[model samples]
Target: MIDRSLFENTETAFELKSDSELERAYFLFKMISSEPLVRIGTAATNFALKAHLPVEKLIRATVFDHFCGGVNEDDCLPVIDKLYTKGVSSVLDYSVEGKSVENQFDNALAKILKIINFCDEREAMPIVVFKPTGFGRFLLYQKKTEGVVLTSEEEAEWGRIVGRFDAVCKLAKEKDVEVLIDGEESWMQDAADDLVEEMMRRYNKDVAVVYNTLQLYRWDRLDYLKQLHKRAKADGFKIGMKIVRGAYMEKERERALDKGYDSPICENKKATDDNFDETLNYILQNLKDISVFIGTHNELSCYLAMDLMKTHNISKEDNRIWFGQLFGMSDHISFNLAAQGYNVAKYIPFGPVKDVMPYLIRRAEENTSVSGQTSRELSLLKTERKRRKL
Candidate 1:
């Protein structure tokens, strides 16, 4: 269990700001903790067209303020500086999703390349990330796995996708920054994995500059990691992988049941947790051949990785392993790990407010659905509130 007092102690290693920040944080916590508020807010925005409501303003004021850096890159600098001062780094993610039109895809490609260029110019940005679904149609990615070849126009569009990824990878390699390709739904993941593998082969000959995300909630991801490792060894290049319990578990399970197929998710949470830790151990053991980012909010899993690092006599600054959590949800973990001299970063998402509502809703739903996490946050806030005697 994480020590609640660690966060309560303002002078502790993680460095909470003056009482003012904590007070503001507490107010935000109270808002998110209200089930009725979250339910109505989610419903209003989710069915806004039918509901004919303008709830984006409320969303922008509450959850957006809590979770996102801002709606774009320039707006994220203050948040980046705040985290950096506390010893954490930031991963820049341009969060535009679900684009299908070729020109729109091309424009997103340019925007991402620009973000990478900006990162190249900044000292604080260590990683640049993008979701494949952000750059292409989901159905097209699904089609690739079915052995359905694309038409001439589709092939040209596909080339543009490859070109965009290549541009990002090449710039990352040149700038010595890491590029993390976010994982997508399972139906579209095979194409993403293939694209990442190709980039890793091309750019990872000397160092790991390209990483593919692995969603371990999928029952087969452990073996997939092993296979990726084998391929990396055969190709004589270091493998880069980011491991998570997964972001789409509920959707994946529901889809599987609806389609009469076995769910790819682990049979139980214990299995998922076990597999996540086991995979961490596997990557640690092969640290020379693989670089891993342990992207999880689970405390035990985080500690297990830390303990393993110590057992192996690995330096806290070892570039091969990093610890990351999303921007707002796990500041306690991210900041505390950074204070301990570990390589840690927050995944900072930036985009227009309207464009990123889906991301925002998913975050709210995640916190609300995860048993006890909100309660824990509430408990921490109340503890701190008591500490301050407010």
Candidate 2:
């Protein structure tokens, strides 16, 4: 059996971090553990950016440098290479969000396509990711999700969105690089699901070239995956899924309350954990037909996945299964798993500092909201620091 205490090895976990970097990680998590600080800091950062205050350098040096790889793809090469030396791969995510223009969509598409090309060239990068909204407007997706009829102009615009998805997936297929399409709000996910399913049908005939994310915080996602599996089997195509506990729980609950509808999110954190584990088991049991990218920072969920893989007799190096964590957090899980020869990748968010604030702010808020997440990070960093006598 694999070592149950594998993740407790601080030496293996923080081997790549220098003394100063370790202290920085500890300090960052300490700050994130306070809920009020995250709220006030988020507001202040947003205001500063809008008022043209010179906070970009401060952000870049501290949170941005820690959470993000760099400001662009080329700038990320050294980080990508560094992680690879320790057996972890990198997924370059162009994380600028909330754009609603044709040119912006085109720029996002160009960025992803370029990242795919980078994946093809670099052995350290085997996968690329994009958000559905990155290729089109959010309202367009919401309208289609709610079954509203689109005007002719909206239809033409959506057609461009489809073209963008196709262009990336096609290049990904040609280059043999895996593509992960991120999940968003449930109010607009139906349309995104249909579009991604179509991409899977086109590019995943031989392998899972295009993957759709499943935010398992939604209780219905396992059923959704099961139904999608039936369709994939009937149609003779593979399935790729990146499953997460989700990133928008507060927004989801607020929207449900405002609209007088049942929340799509699981009733509570425990339910979400159960849902994630159940889905993980299902995917591991059906690994031959479905590939999974397990995106999580929870130690229990990570352990559950490792146990499931062992019970299913799956190889540690299986390409169809990967364990992923965000770039700056969860180094214990990522490096420990990689040290044990399990397939692992870190989602490395990259963009200009000002443009990436939304993503960074969300990260900070999520760290504060998720119980024990920030504390676990701090605890691990402390352990590593003590081990190093820092």
Candidate 3:
């Protein structure tokens, strides 16, 4: 087992103050802890925003600070530099969600291309990330999977999605930056998988320029990973896989029930955890053909990967194995891993306050829901505050 002292040292490094910032974080924690209010209010706020209400200021002050890098790429530079100074790398994510317009899709694609270009210019920014839904309508993605032929307009939208991905991958290849495509809802996943497979086939021959995110919480993903490995081996290319425990559990379960289909989600958290660790072991064993980014906050999972690395005599700087957490959560895991000479990056999302509200709310809600995570953070902050005698 990894020593508990590692976490203690990691928490101390943050040097948190017991001032207004800590107080605000506590308040938000309490608010999100109120399960009834969080459920009702999150739903209501999502609805209100869809109805075009003005709540950007509130979002920016609270959850945005806790999750997003900033409002745009330029806005993210200082934060990226700060992480670089701390020996942590940044994966730049443009956090816009749930759009259906062609122009909006095209704009998102253009912005992602620009981000790729920016990362190319900045050596510190090693990974450029995107969600396919950001560049294509969710409904269109669903329809495409259902064997529905697209109309001319829909075909044009599909072209835009392809164009966006191609542009990002081309820039990433040129700049030698890895592009990490995020996982999405099960219904929309087929389209994402198809697109990512195409990109991998085209650009992953030399190095892993494109990565497909696999959410291990899905019951079928382990097998899917194996199949992808087979395809990559047969095609004579490296496969880059970013593994997460998934984020859309509740939504997926509800949708599965509503649509009268079996849920694709793992039966419980333990099952998911088991699958995740097993998948990590598989990837480590197949390190020659696969590059893996272990995007997790679980300490055991992190150590499990480390243990596999040691057993296999894999170098800490292999570049094929990486560890990542989101920007605000799991600093102990991310910073400590990096400090210990492992490749670690934080998933730093940035966008307009209004556009990133969903992402922020998810972070807030996740902190409150992930067993002891919020309490652990609060306790650490308080301990650091007391240590500073504030």
Candidate 4:
């Protein structure tokens, strides 16, 4: 049986965090716990960034440093090496978002290819991540998802997008690195899913080289996974998945309401949690055909995964299963799991300070909106602080 209190070990969780870093984390979470402060901070930061009023230094020292690995891949090496010392791996995430041009798309593809090469060289980094929209325009994906016929020009553009995906996934396969394609909003997800499935069929013939993100908060995802599994089995391929409760909850619900369509999101938090756990169970039961990266910060879910693995006679260090949390959040879950000899990886977001603000702001807003998330982080930091007599 897994220990119920494994995640409460502050010393193991904060061993890498310096005394000042612990205090900074406590202060950051305390500030993030206030919804109003988060809203105001997000607005002010965005305005300051647009105005070019020199807030980048302040943001870099505070939230950016805490949440992100660094501004570039080279800058992230030290951070990645340090985490690996604790037996945790890293997925280098190039987090620049919102590109609309072909040149920008090519740049994103080049960055990912470079990261895959980087991952190949570094023992600490076995995976790389990119968003579907990062390689092409969001509307292109939306058009494809809605089954709308595309113009010749649009088709040519999308062909380039597909080429970009192929380049990265092909390189990852050659280098023996895993590639994770992040999931976006429900409207654009279908096209992305179809594309990722193709990549999996091609590169996952021998092993899982391509992973698709499944946002379990979407009520239809478990069915989607099962269907994908059946197809993979018949086609002689493996299914690689990174499952999460999801981001974009507010946007998804609001869009569904505005369009008078049923929300794709589960009806409530309990339903989403149950859906995540059930999906986790399903993946664990089919580990031979499916490899999962369990992306969550919930301790109960982590404990549940541990218990299930034990029940299934799976070894703690199995390569087919992994636990992942964001770089700045969920130290308790990530580090504690690593200490217990489970495969754990941190998603380390990196980009220029200005370009990464949107990702960081969203992280803060999500922490504030998710009930008890910020409080748990603050409580853990406080416990560590008291233990160190700070």
lDDT of 2 by residue, 87-122 (tens): 999999999989999999999989999899889998
Residue 125 in model 1: lDDT = 84
> Candidate 3 residues 214-265, lDDT tens each?
9988999999989988988998888899999999999999999999999999
Arranged by lDDT with the best first, the candidates are 4, 2, 3, 1
For each of the candidates, the C-alpha root-mean-square deviation to the true structure, in angstroms, is: 2.6, 1.1, 2.5, 0.9
Off by over 4 Å in 2: none
All candidates: TM-score: 0.92, 0.98, 0.92, 0.99
lDDT of each: 0.81, 0.92, 0.84, 0.94
Candidate 3, pairs of clashing residues = none
Candidate 1 vs candidate 3, lDDT winner: 3
Candidate 1 — which residues are off by over 4 angstroms? 1-21, 34-36, 46-58
Residue ranges of candidate 4 with Cα displaced over 4 Å: none
- lDDT tens digits, residue span 320-385, model 1: 999999876666677778877899999888787778877877777777777777777666666656
Best candidate per TM-score, number?
4
Residues 1-390, candidate 4, lDDT per residue (tens digit)?
A: 888989999999999999888888988999999989999999999999999998999999999999999999999999999999999999999988888998999999999999999999998999889999999999999999999999999999999999999999999999999888899999999999999999999899978889999999999999999999999999999999999999989899999999999999999999999999999999999999999989999999999999999999999998889899999999999999999999999999999999999899989988988998989998888888888995
Question: Which candidate has the top score in lDDT?
Answer: 4
Q: What's the lDDT for residue 206 in model 1?
A: 87
**What is the overall TM-score of model 3 with all chains considered together?**
0.92
